[model samples]
Target: MKKHCMGRVVAASAVLVSSGAIAFVPASAASATEADCDGIGVIGVFKAVESGASFNYNGRRVELQNESALDRYSRAEIKSGRKAGDRLWVDRSFHAFPDFKGIVSDQSAKSDGWKMCGPYTGSRTQSVFNANYAARACAEIDGTTLCGKWYVD
Candidate 1:
């Protein structure tokens, strides 16, 4: 459910930003959206951002400035091999997302989707799932970058 909320927020933000009606946003915000991100290495798994929007990557909690920022940080975290739940600071001031590369743990990768070792309680502790399922399923049951699923055993 959290992921869905964040996703909606990001989607809505994109609309607002494109419409040129979102106030208090930096002028460079337009550029950030057009960040030629293709071919750019993944920054890291997005944790929580200063504004409270967040997501799960490799079963870790990540926050971001918004959904777009979360997506950027999520990729970076995976590529950098940072541990689950690590934080990546998005520096919109510099148009960069920075990570602390040394904190990674070399753990074995797990299957895609939610891996619940126990019963589900519909809470943050139940199991990791695809961000899209939004808590409907005990686990999303697969992992993929496109859908923003990142669960490691």
Candidate 2:
């Protein structure tokens, strides 16, 4: 099953490569962030710490970039994968992420674009930023980062 799944990914990659949709790079090779976010590149998938939500930082760790850039890439990720159903859909259970902005380190200010629902006020449309780091009473007030608790299924 794993091999079959990987085969699909490889075939998809080949099609993308041939059509100039994305460049072809060996899995062992290093590519730029644009390539990674461009469908032709590999995205690093991360599971939500709490709800088992699955997401990708567009190949960069969420812990690394600024909010603006993160938003840009995340938007791309969401739009790029509709056919594959690779979106960060919030479950009806939790409903939404908390409002009221909190300050995040300037280091974490950028995001890969699509945060779960909570951090951006229940609108998956909002971008995640360092200013909205996990501390500010989002869901329960004084809780941990929303990303740590929310699922992206």
**Candidate 2 segments exceeding 4 Å error:** 1-65, 69-76, 79-81, 89-124, 132-153
Query: Model 2 over residues 1-153: C-alpha lDDT tens digits?
Result: 111112211111221223222222233211122221222222334222211122222331122222232331222112222222222212111122245332332113212222222222222222222232331111111221112122121
Q: What lDDT score is found at residue 2 in candidate 2?
A: 12
Model 1, position 70: C-alpha lDDT score: 41
lDDT of each: 0.22, 0.22
Residues 59-104 of candidate 1 have per-residue lDDT tens digits of 5443222124443222222222344322232211111113221111
Q: Indicate the worst ten consecutive residues by lDDT in candidate 2.
A: 1-10
What C-alpha lDDT, on a 0 to 100 scale, does residue 51 get in candidate 1? Answer: 21
Poorly placed runs, candidate 1 (over 4 Å): 1-35, 38-48, 65-141, 144-153
User: Tell me, what's the RMSD of every candidate?
Assistant: 18.1, 18.4
